[model samples]
Target: MKKKVWLSIKGKQQTQDQEAEIIELLTEGELYNKDKSQYILYKESEVSGMEGTTTTVKIEGDQVTIIRLGTTNSHLVFKKGKKKYNRYETPYGDLLMSISTKNVDVEYNEEKDPIAIHLDYNMEIDGAHGSRNTLDIQVKH
Candidate 1:
């Protein structure tokens, strides 16, 4: 079933908080359960500067992965208390980035499917502390 998705992100750095939000249709989304793990697939529209890009999110077990492809290419993996590194490709160039997840919270629907996800993490780029971040995703059928 297709659903409406609302995403909100907040970043805190140097005592300042910056927030951004997007509300869009979920192009492709599904939830799967197997063994002791659950998986989610979510895709959304291309954004402004990210012209040809498609944003895809996958959640499995306690890890969340986000990928952007087309105009820009990047992969980010967030696992609680673990730091993961990756390179972000942009029009300008490539950027080295690291993400350390602090917490992950999930809310489920009556069907045992995920209806919301909340993540708290810290990010660093090129070895410098970037921001503490919070991302919330909610879906409605």
Candidate 2:
């Protein structure tokens, strides 16, 4: 049962001594539940700098997965106290990416569907340390 939804996605990234960089996007997406997991799907617009791309987010307990297709391609996973690896593909080049998750917090609705999610992690790209990052997503009716 997929339902239309509005998403507020916010992210912040900070290097060792650099100022935190932030991005916020408000977009319409679809939401559904299946196989004990919840999914959110949306298309990336030019404002997000990934036009023509579609993003899907899956949430199950404290683990979250984000997949992107089209202009960019990537599979990123986040689980508290775990490190996940993947390749991020782009027109320029593909990079080896790794995510070390420090925390995952989720807020759920009465139906056990997630209404909000927050993740804290560190990222490495091409074997080089990148940034300490946070991603927050809020779902609106």
Candidate 3:
């Protein structure tokens, strides 16, 4: 059993809000299965004065590759490609944004009553500026 977690980012320059929603839409609807793969969707919103833009990103494969989709210049678009594990520099700090064999790691801790999954992501964005975004996801079943 596996689940899909969706993260959305919104707000204005210098300040951005990141929200993540996890949904179990698989047939088993469980979260601690080692045989299943999890799906991830990420989105970011940027606002400048009275205008704003939102970008949606998707990551597939068993931590092999990452796919991103969004809009540029107010037009819908998709970025289909693959990149080796790498890091970039940003306003907040240094970031390593990659979806490779060793980039995205998921661990299941069963010491608690319900299992928990921990995700750590270090990434960067280009706009008027860039900021470091960090998120923690814990799921109980």
Candidate 4:
């Protein structure tokens, strides 16, 4: 089945335009799947004036690994980081965001709506100073 995932980031100190830009970045990328029923969707955004990158990688496996890194450009700034973006977060105090919607313990709920995968994201604006944000997402099949 084809899957579509949506991501959104919100913060108190972020501007409306910045929020929109983040959303755009999240939805701009495509989900990567190495096997059927298992996939990964990654999204990232940079806070203007803030030198950092935030990336989210949704892995379908039971255990997911999140790594944060530091980058000088946006998520799409280059093609090399595109795939590795999920493995590490840029050192820019960016949070690695991801959600696993595949539940094997319970049967699929056909009547219920897709659940929103919420992730707490924290990033440092400067060395020690930073802000906290929430990433709300939904994965649909």
lDDT of 3 by residue, 1-141 (tens): 334433322212122454433332211122222334343323333332211322222222323222333332221111223333444433445444442121343444463222222223333333222333223333334
Instruction: Output the lDDT of residue 91, model 2.
Output: 78
In candidate 4, position 128 carries an lDDT of: 34
By TM-score, who's the top model here? 2
* Candidate 1 residue lDDT tens string, 1-141: 433444433233331354533333434455555555555544434433466676666677788787888878999888888999999999899999988889987787897667787888888889874777777666554
Which residue pairs collide, candidate 1?
A: none
Residue 64, candidate 4: C-alpha displacement in angstroms: 5.0
Q: Over the stretch 8-79, how does candidate 2's per-residue lDDT look in tens digits?
A: 999999998789989899999999988988899999988778899999999987799999999999999999
lDDT of 2: 0.92
After superposition, candidate 1 runs with Cα above 4 Å error:
1-48
What is the lDDT of every predicted structure here? Answer: 0.68, 0.92, 0.30, 0.36
Number of clashing pairs per prediction, in order: 0, 0, 0, 8
Kindly give the stretch of ten consecutive residues in candidate 1 with the minimal lDDT sum: 7-16
Off by over 4 Å in 2: none
TM-score of 4: 0.35
Sort the candidates on TM-score, descending order.
Answer: 2, 1, 4, 3
Cα lDDT of model 4 by residue, 57-99, tens digit: 4344332333323463333211111222222234444444322
Stretches off by above 4 angstroms in model 4 are 1-38, 42-56, 60-115
Show the colliding residue pairs in model 4.
56-97, 67-89, 68-89, 69-89, 69-90, 69-91, 70-90, 70-91
Please identify which of the two predictions, 1 or 4, would achieve the higher TM-score against the true structure: 1
